[model samples]
Target: MTPTVISPASPVELLHYMITYQRYPTTLLICSSDDEFRAAIAEELKGQIPEEQLQQEPDEFGEVIIDHPLAALPIFRRVVARHLRVLFVPSVIHLRAILSVFSQADSPIPPPPEEDSENTKQGARPRPPSLFAYGFLELHRDSSEWSAQGLSSSASMFVAAARRSGFNPVMVEPKAAGGLANFEHVLREHAPILSGGARRDEGWQGRTVEVRRVFDRWFRFQTGQWDIKWPEDNAS
Candidate 1:
């Protein structure tokens, strides 16, 4: 199935929709070559979303960190078990590496043999469940049509990998002509509403409907019923 491209009208609208309409287990994972953008997003989401809902890759304890992407399989399995809904990947390179791991049809090597005798007294570890209705964030340098095409190619690769790994993936890229400043502005504007105890505007509901339409398109695209065209360029 061809992947559908989504270009949100604005960052504020996207955040509003995510916070208001997204289902439970709504965790966002941020990964980047540097932590600047991730830090910015975390700062913006401070009062808006609960601190527990946002998580960083590698984590504070360095438990999930891995030198090779394939080594992260256990971590990915755990994240899926936890039912994380959103993953904000800022680094294109990191995103590609993760996708490569998922693209594998099956494990290349056999599982380690179970311990004998004494180990039989202990129970085996539980496995992670399948992921569903998950979202991924992609940040680009500009909003040009050329950039959009490049993003489409990346999204296609991501969706294909996710499907192969037994996940239903939806990619979202919020429009911000003014770049980071614009994103900050939008988040600030909606901070009050996101913090709670305020009536939601009718316009926010309208935007939610619009965003839902985008997700519907993604769902339809996954079925291969739609004649969506994928770019020749494939993300490695």
Candidate 2:
């Protein structure tokens, strides 16, 4: 529930979630160690999003990125802090870096890691933001075989780590030919956690208690014996 979903159509779904789900200005963060795939994804995004919306500023939704593995996590931390909403599609290596924050058994929103010398400006103790940006991370399966016996072919050591760690990525599968529309519907189903307005305090007393439920869910994630939630236990 770290505001990231895992699916095959991640880049497409990330854009769909950002633009179609809400009007708040957001950033599309591309995390890659090289420009090998960034350019192609950028071109594809251009076709779906208007030219004006791609401007990288607070006034408008925009596309931003980190092409360095070392700088990816620190920069992403800053981006999510600055922008109210951010939909990031990160390379696998970069994804792990972004997710490492959750593994630390310390503060929920701890300051940037010590290794990030560039984050010296982020004060000694930064207060956690009330709300967070949501997005997707693409799951890629290399042809490598599982070292553990009897595990499914899809379950590699890395995949198992993802399942147990604080990465806590929600697994989503695209329906056959369901297209972006189907994914949007599914996102609507998961909106309690994914929506930017999820943390809004106004009119909470009148709502059907979704806000309270959200708080309990987060509390469970922080205090539970296992930080990860089984996909089948909560949802199909």
Candidate 3:
């Protein structure tokens, strides 16, 4: 029988989506050596979506999967400039698109190695749409005693960990440009809950974060409500 997992919070929901979508837009899984934890995550995911959609990869990256339908979705890729190493910017979707584009390359793309604690400090980078759209999936041990306070505290830590994982971790607030702030605010507000400790920081501090909001029009277009209107982004 397929395992069933329950997620009482939105963070879990986001993780389910991220894990499920891995098979689609791009099939890449990032997991640790813990099988039980991975199984728990997969079970929790079964609660969110159907079992047929998930496929696992048995290799160094561990049991990973991508949604079959999203196989046709185009991906984007961006290089992490050494100067912007610690910044968590851009949405995960945007990163996914970027990575998908880069995955086309025949070479094996490498993830950033674990950062040395002594050389780290707070930093900022441009936020992309994917990160905002997907939010983040922070895994924590069930044995760890976590309260509401811990969830809030861990948000920052998860972002930091994402940076170490080679993704931008932008500090989004309730208000910011490109609807970036709004998207993150909504995601976190609607984010699924999970076990964790206190957050490392309260919020972010940055003046110039190139953020863009995905307006209702984009959704409308996505849903076939109207034709798609893409902005002329020279940066890409």
Q: Please tell me which predicted candidate would have the highest TM-score against the true structure.
A: 1
TM-score of every prediction relative to native: 0.35, 0.29, 0.23
lDDT of 2 by residue, 1-236 (tens): 34333322433444344334422122233433325334544545556665565544433344353233223333334334433233344444444455443232332333334424634566753322222212221132111111111112222322333444433323333332223344434332212222122223442122222312322332222221122368876895
Query: On TM-score, who's better, 1 or 3?
Result: 1
User: Which candidate do you rate higher for lDDT, 1 or 3?
Assistant: 1
**What are the runs in model 3 whose C-alpha is more than 4 Å off?**
1-33, 37-108, 111-141, 160-236
lDDT of residue 76 for candidate 3:
18
Q: What's the true lDDT of residue 194 in model 3?
A: 34
**For model 2, which pairs clash?**
none
Give the runs in model 2 whose Cα sits over 4 Å from its true position. 1-12, 15-37, 50-79, 82-102, 105-142, 146-167, 172-236
Error of 1 at 134 (Å): 9.8
lDDT tens readout by residue for model 3, 108-159: 4333353333236456332221222222222221223232333344443433
Q: Which one wins by lDDT: 2 or 3?
A: 2
lDDT of 3 at 129: 17
